[model samples]
Target: MVIPIHDKNPVSRAPVVTYGLIIANVVVFLLGPIAFAGPDPDAGRKARENAYLYHYGAIPSQLLGGAHGGHGAPVWPAFTAIFVHAGWIHLLGNMLFLYIFGNNVEDQFGRVHYLLFYIVGGALSTYAFAWANPTANAPLVGASGAIAAVLGAYAFLFPQARVTLLLPFLWFLPLRVPAWLVLGFWFVMQLPEFQQTIGVSSSSDVAYYAHVSGFVLGLVYAALVIGRGRGPDDPLRLRQKAESEGSGTPPLAPDYRSADPDDPYGQYHR
Candidate 1:
């Protein structure tokens, strides 16, 4: 297993939307265990958890307009599911990915677009899972699908950026690998599960298709945006005024560019 710990990339601006998302997810998770406080705290916590999931988490059958579980309209759950988590590990893992990758993506698109991208990516993920298993009655929850979109964007937008990963194969030693290798390997690993789920031959409870779909969605989204010349405020162009006036070359390196630019080989520097 390889766990991503950090990255060496820097963003052009503060990721306000990314921080808001992390906080929102954490707050929602904390509210779950105490939502139904009663005579028995433990039992209440457990009951509240179940209630939270059933009422707010997206159920495949329900999302597909089936009668399974007979939950009401799926709109709220489709949006809320991204904020709901199964446990601390699930919450932390998703948040870590969001914290690490989301900033750069947000930095590229600005706060509003980034927020919209996240919500739309999550909604699309839920729909993908529902399409993959329209008969499934299980409630799907977590920010994994959404964060998978962020990873997808990172894979495309910052493929050469270095990320530190702790691999169990190397006795948990850290390895600084390029973003493409890490995210690409992860997307490839999900293929087997995605195929199994499509073939209706897997027993895994995890939603692999959602992860795959979100990734693809994010990849396409980023590709379209970047193709249309939308990118982090062009650092080079922004300094053109000073450079044109011969202000000592603006004090920054030309190679310090966005992940994808007209020149793909330009190396990103600190």
Candidate 2:
């Protein structure tokens, strides 16, 4: 599969924080088995490791209660699992997508709103997973669910934006594709997995349902919380619209005018 690297139309706000998140995920992954390994080394080791994930990861039984291995008590996994990844590749891959797409979404919602939206999307994703595979005891880890939400929001808000991806065929080559096409195809591809496994037990390890559900949740949440033409970090929507209506000219330059142009050496100016 091709790996995404960057996007054409990135958020105009602080992107440093987005990069910081990528760094954090990388560092955490490098810390190795100590942080993610299960409580027991043996005794259904894979299941136990995943159980720690289920206990700390998103589990539907914990959300809905008393149906199919549903945990009728409080679900703590929702919060912790957002930061916990299954492995280095898993962490790196998820963080890379987040690094590319999260800044714009965060800018749209502001840091606090974006963070809350991420957590909520993760919770919803867990709920969907638990609902889909109520009896499975496998551990679910990683930020894929939350990242899927970010992708959904990105796809909706910046459909025209382009993403730079590394396509590996004979060798690694970079290609730029529109965000709408990439994310839209991804969202569509997830649907069949959901349909095929609707009421059946998930024999496969991957929680495809959670990814699909989280993406939909992100789109819906973005539509509701971040309504049309109201991205906090994107003030160009109106200008773009005006340009389109008036002369079909390209949108005006982003408003980067300093509040006081005279302060040439101020940190803001710098």
Write candidate 1's Cα lDDT for 63-144 as tens digits. 8775535346566677888999877777888898898789989987789988999998998999999998988877899988
Whose TM-score is greatest here?
Answer: 1
**How many clashes does each candidate structure show, in the order listed?**
0, 5
lDDT of 2 by residue, 86-200 (tens): 7656777788788778887887678877877887788779777888877665567678888899899887777766666776784777766777888886776566555465553
Clashing pairs for predicted structure model 1, backbone only: none
Supply candidate 2's per-residue lDDT for 64: 58
- Superposed Cα deviation of residue 168, candidate 1 (Å): 1.9
Given candidate 1, what's the lDDT at residue 65?
79
lDDT of 1: 0.78
> Per-candidate TM vs. native?
0.79, 0.74
The TM-score, computed over Cα atoms with residue i paired to residue i, of candidate 1 is: 0.79
Whole-model alpha-carbon lDDT for candidate 2: 0.67
